[model samples]
Target chain A: MQGAITIEGVDKRYISRGRETVALDSVSLNIQPGELVSFVGPSGCGKSTLMNMIAGIVPMTNGRIIHNGKKVSGINRDVGYMTQADSVLPWRTVEKNVALPLEYRGVRTQERKQRVDEMLKLVELEGFNKSFPRELSGGMRKRVALAQMLAYSPNTLLLDEPFGALDAQLKMVMQQQLLNIWREQKKTIVLVTHDLSEAIAVSNRVVVLSGRPGRIKHIENIDIPHPRDVFKVRFLPEFERAYDSLWEQLSSEITKGESL
Target chain B: MQVDESAAVGTGLNTGGSSKAVLAYEAGLEQRKMMVRVSQVLFAIVFLSFWQWASGRIIDPFFVSSPLAVGGRLYEWTLNGQLWSHLSVTMLATAFGFFIGAGIGFALGLLFGKFAFLAEVMDPFITALYSIPKLALAPLFIIWFGIGIESKIAVSASIVFFVVFLNTFAGVRDVSQIYIHSTQIMGASNWAVLRTVVIPSATAWVITGLKVSVPYALVGTVIGEFMSSNRGIGYIIAQATGLFDTNSVFAGIVILMVVGAIINGLLKKTEGWLLRWKE
Candidate 1:
């Protein structure tokens, strides 16, 4: 596909107080256009670092990333990013916050409202357009954040554990909603999450990374068909095999990661 | 303490248990409000009557003016229109100084907040100047702007500038880094980030700064008038002091207190309106 992202031999290092910390080492991956891929790993595995690089918000220590056909540079505005923390502007109402990306794109006022209204409906937040971020529940706020990310119709999405903070039931609901949206929009999504079941439920492929100075431990294909029910996916035989194999690799890394 | 409805019903204290509890709680609240009102009125009456008695007895009336004398002086000023003439001058000076100082301070504060390197370079100088009492600059202002309201405006602006500057600076600096990042990811330019995120976040702090500096602005105006002015409330107080007219001084002080209280109440109302979203 034309809008594919190729991450080649990317490495990231952090230097603070005369100390060196290697966050990612010789990491490489290829994400096809319209594919939903999850980077599943233990904490400190540099999943977030990889997401940042893809978004072009952070510089890598070495190697490069190609977005669409161009080399990724400062702030790849072609992609939408959703972080673990709800980053909705508290001062803005729901509709206004969601319309931010559209506003940044210089979309006109009337068009912005129409687009925001549609997005709010998609997220089931039609009536909450005037409510401030502080007034919304956690799930509702996450919906707003998701709506914000999708507002500008970006070609790709870089989600760094966007639903990690949610409870299990909410997470499942969000996953189902995300799947529904993905089916409709068909944008390339690169998700960073430590939740193994979450990776299997939503993503077509799960890339498992090792501990600190993270390396690709394994990449598993989840053959579960689209329009899959997230609530019932775990009961499937295909899902069981995918889970067992991925968990076997991930648990070892988790133990090793914890020791560090 | 509240008794839960189901628990109270189980104990058979009252069949309409929850409603009764709610009624009792509401009654208690009303009783408290009445008590507060009674105490306030009683305290005011007792204090004013004691001051009316003590001014000429325990304390010399020449030093501490009696309440009755102060009241009479206020009545005399009101009847002759002297109070309005002096009060208008002070109010005009204070309003001019407050707006001008607060405006300039807000503008520069936003500029400095966005440009950290510039703020850092000017930090020591700004702090040094801010530390010096604004009243000390009154004579210099008088020399530059003369004894008119211009001098008072300059002095009040100087005082208000630092208060607002410090508040706006801290508010802008303290905006969450995550929020900024999120805005940028949505393809926002630096200017867009400031407009949508920084300004709104810092508004509360800026308003707080404005509210806090109101009294200081008044102080600067009064001090300027006290130094040298032909007409103002401060002039009235200065004149009373010169003549040892304690009652006039007391009246001037009471007038100032009333003005300050009204201004403070208005400011609080404005703050509540602006930050209503926070609730």
Candidate 2:
């Protein structure tokens, strides 16, 4: 029950220079505890906006989001949020960066060290504790970020294209790592991504959103069982069918968005 | 060929050629460094000799004092304790002004950087104030603080304030939004976020500002002394010029050059230690 989230009629609007723009309109969704859901849509879709709302970083213009039966007002600390950009503090070494959330929670030094070590091992970056972010390669930095996010063991994770910047080979490796973590931890995850195959490969359900003033267009149940090989999952018949159906829904929305 | 073979063997693998290449590259770098040092020493010798040779023949020695006369004057001052008294006074003024100015500027920068409304409201006024040539205010500072060390401190502090203030402001304002959001999501309080993310991130800019402002602080001090002072190096120069003692004037200028170089070296050391993470 700790990871369950209910978003009711969430709307986001931005008024700038006296021009009102609707970013998301009456978008509603329910994510059960331990559910892995992927949100996919065109470029302008409110996919990231919805994720931000769930994390309570961005305030909704109207409606509400409930996590664990409590209304999320601001900065929901129960969830970990990983943005597209690498958010590892450049000034901190890998160990210190991973220790940040634990430090914020007032965890003692010894426990923080233990947790940080565990996270580094989880992300396969066990030997990189003393290295600064600038010293690490792109994929390694991402691993550091992942380690940092997992350090505090948040019940839920809101990832907005966390692997978007990675090359294809690294992306698959990361996806495999993510799936393995998901299986072990069973934390509720809401991933916002543009990659259709990524959406279908890892999630229990893939939510397709329409462009601009986004609304849910179609929800596809990915019946492909887990312990999924992210590299080979696409070869499954069910995976193919789901990808084709979701692409059909998503492409039309993208074309309509471009015309506008 | 023998050295290369030995180096390759020492490296213990297929990287033998690369190890030899590295050794050659390092030797070349060392050779270059030695060449640069030798050239620098030769250049200084030639330039000083030319200046000494040409002082009486090409230009009047009175107008362009010879290096020997300046050195003699410095030796006399050092023996008589005049150098220590004047140098100490100037150093004290510079130190006090640098600390006070940098402290206030850093504080105000954090204040304005955190509050966008306050910064926006004060932007035009701050810009207008900053536009005024700071040296032009030395006379005003002298009048307010009198012709003592206080005025010199005031002048130097005023000059340093703007530089530190602007750099600190930009540093704080430019902290990455993602960093702030990441900490916030981790349940960091506003105070925690500022301490952890804002301050540490802005340290590079703040240190750069401090480094840049050191010379400005000294300039302000000397200018203040020039406008009105009885004791610092600037006063020595002013007094020597009034007496038409070109040797003493050049001596004071040489002392200042040495002082500036020493201070700059110290600052570089501090900067290296403070920003070691940049490597």
DockQ of each: 0.35, 0.38
Tens-digit lDDT track of model 2 for B1-279: 223322433321234356777889999999999999999999989998999999999999999899999989999999999999999999999999999999999999999999999999999999999999999999999989999999999988998999999999999999999899889999799998988899988999999999999999999999899889999999999999999999999999999999999999999998887676786
> Which residue ranges in model 1 land beyond 4 Å of their true spot?
A1-3, B1-35
Q: For model 1, how does the per-residue alpha-carbon lDDT over A1-260 read when each residue is reduced to its tens digit?
A: 55599989998999989999999999999999999999988898899888888877789999999998889888888888998887998888888999999999899999999999999888877667787877677777888999998889888988898888877887888899999989999989999988888999999999999999899989999999988899999999999999999999999998997776
What are the TM-scores, per candidate, against the unseen true structure? 0.92, 0.93
Model 2: per-residue lDDT, tens digit, A67-173? 98899998888998989888999888889999999889899999999999899888877666887777666777888888888888898999999999888887988
Q: Categorize the docking of model 1.
A: acceptable
How far in Å is the alpha carbon of B168 misplaced in model 2? 1.2
- Model 1 C-alpha lDDT versus the unseen true structure: 0.89
lDDT of each residue in B234-274, candidate 1, tens digit only: 99999999999999999999999999999999999999987
